[model samples]
Target: MSEILARLAAVEEENRQLRQEVEALRRDHADHRETVGREIASDRRRITALETPAPALREKTAEDHVNRLFSEMRRLNIRQTTAKDAARLLGVSKPLIDKLKPYLATDPRFLILRDPHHKQRHLIRLAGT
Candidate 1:
């Protein structure tokens, strides 16, 4: 009877230890899951940032095009040009010339004028010339 009771006590102690081990494993699993979730969220944010296009790059490219257009006009000694002629000189579409009108209008180096002979035509010229 004494031997049987000792054996039973040993079994109970082993069961308690197993339960503690299982609880520790659960806690470790929870921590691992939390860490993985945070990493996934961070990756998503990085992806979103990468996917968004940069507007500054487009604006810089447009500014370069405008500068090139001005250089070409100066090289050709063109004091003034119609939108169609400017588009042809710049090797760009007429709609692009229309888009550039705002930039030309705002710049102190350039002037925009309405054609007296043709109401539909606008003349772009170097300022003060």
Candidate 2:
């Protein structure tokens, strides 16, 4: 009878140890799940940031185009050119040059003249020249 009681006590002790191990395993599993979930959320945030588009570029203003035209004319040593030629040199539409005509006429840095060779054409020149 005493031997049977001893065996029963040993079995009970092993069962208690197994329960402790199972509880430890459950805690470790919860921690692992929490870590994985956090990593997934971080990865999703990174993906969202990467997918967002950049802001649109700023459009060039008329003054900016005019400055570029003037710079090109000076660099090429052009004293005078017709509106059509100026538009071609500046890589802009003729209508844009037409829009700038009034401003160029009033500007102190430029001269507007009638082309002697072409009755229908106007010439643009630097003010000093």
Top candidate on lDDT is 1
* Clashing residue pairs, backbone N/CA/C < 3 A, model 2: none
lDDT of 1 by residue, 1-129 (tens): 999999999999999999999999999999999999999999999999999964343566567767877888899999988999999997888977887888888877789999888989999998868
* Model 2 TM-score on a 0 to 1 scale: 0.51
Where model 2 places Cα greater than 4 Å from the true spot, the runs are 1-60
TM-score between model 1 and native: 0.53
lDDT of each: 0.87, 0.84
Give candidate 1 regions above 4 Å deviation: 1-57
- Deviation (Å) of 62 in candidate 2: 2.5
